[model samples]
Target: MEARLPYDDYPVVFLPPYESPPAWVPPHERLYHPDYNNELTQFLPRTVVLKKPPGAQLGFNIRGGKASQLGIFISKVIPDSDAHRAGLQEGDQVLSVNDVDFQDIEHSKAVEILKTAREITMRVRYFPYNYQRQKERTVH
Candidate 1:
């Protein structure tokens, strides 16, 4: 038998015994708390600015952003290219391009956005696991 909390219907937010979430904390929002996950720092989001001269390529290929794969992701980072130099890596999820959210964007639309942006400020995070767990959470 499982032990019941004082409020069984409400979920509990459990952090490490030594650490506590600052101020008021909600169970669903614990993920946004910096100290909530030990792996947060390891998968920190980083910003990359890319400028491509006319008739030049940005040096990266993107994949995903379909029903099967819901987020735009970096599939390749060509060596010696600007993307590689900026530390872009394969499997990096493109959170946004020019500040436009790309997480649930369409494949063709994402391509068009990137191609049209002469200089793009991309916010991405490297999630080695591809963040399937988070996707599953959002589905419900």
Candidate 2:
């Protein structure tokens, strides 16, 4: 029987049978911390830099901000888009965009920052399992 660790929608095997860790993981893709007590439990912040082609969209949806008090989160990502190719994912918290701090920015302001930039460098962190709980904690 395959022992599996549960996730909200993505169950994974505890480990691959007798396989050693990868010889290397890309810096942006490394799992730097695994402690439950860490505010970010399972993922590391990835800096993704994307430059939108002329007249083309960045192709991602965002949610949350200071007004909403939910924090900035990536609500959707379009497949094959630059954002997707850069490794942005749904539920990723946008810590910064174009190096502008997003943690306390208003919704309208956040929208403006994303819309105005031709090139964006963002630090994003994804925490799928405890997303709602984390948001709640941040709110309180």
Q: Which candidate achieves the best TM-score against the true structure? A: 1
- In order, candidate lDDTs are 0.79, 0.76
Candidate 1's C-alpha runs over 4 A off are 1-40, 131-140
TM-score of each prediction? 0.63, 0.62
- Residue-level lDDT tens digits of model 2 in 35-85: 223244448888999897667888898777785555788878999988988
**Which lDDT tens digits does candidate 1 get at residues 1-140?**
99876776787787535755467667787777874663566478899999988778989987777554558778778999999999999878899999899988877899998888889899999875664533443331
Top candidate on lDDT is 1
lDDT of 1 at 90: 80
